[model samples]
Target: MVEGAWLWLTLFAIGSTTILTRGSFVLGGEGARLPPALQRALRYAPAAALSALIMPDLLLDAGAFDPANPKLVAGIVVALAAVRSRNPWLPFFAGMGVLLVLRKGLGW
Candidate 1:
């Protein structure tokens, strides 16, 4: 429905806002230092973001919580493998292997 100069203007506004907000730190240089507490909190942002993206898929099935889901089991396996093994790839491969085995080999 939106096709004309208005759409171009809206898109340009959005793009400019995004660039300014995302590049604020770089543009401000050392004067824009974050507080110490905020800096420390940012350290967990990646893990929190990843959990936000993955937890729903792992815990839900057909719009309901599923404790017996194979993905949940695989996630548990991944957590355990990560804790026990030093290699990062081991947990990923182990989780995928468990998932494949459960979904394909055992038909869970």
Candidate 2:
């Protein structure tokens, strides 16, 4: 069992960290602006995050990459849909649809 003081200290630390981290944005009013370089760099954050989230799933299989994996093909379809549609959620649905069709209909 955790010691009472240690548990309380841990909870306090977590609460303080959460408040301080989130409070910065709240305290910075609507008109407050980040530096231009920071703003420009931040623009790639979503793309970077999406790649980080997706690349592993598309590329990896049983600890190795398989070029012929249906997931990779579905991912390609999703990428094309994203480029053509220029919409974020549409790519997700397109990927899901392709994955379903490949897995269920074509039995990939």
Among these predicted structures, which one has the highest lDDT? 1
lDDT of 1: 0.93
What is the clash count for each candidate, in the order shown? 0, 0
Q: Model 2: which ten-residue window has the lowest total lDDT? A: 21-30
Per-candidate TM-score against the hidden true structure: 0.67, 0.57
Query: What lDDT would each prediction earn against the true structure?
Result: 0.93, 0.87
Q: Write the per-residue lDDT of candidate 2 for residues 1-108, one digit (tens) a residue.
A: 767999999889989978886786787777876799998998899899989998988998887977788899999998799789967799899899989999998998
Model 1 segments beyond 4 Å from truth?
Answer: 1-23
The residue-level lDDT of candidate 2 at 63 comes to 72
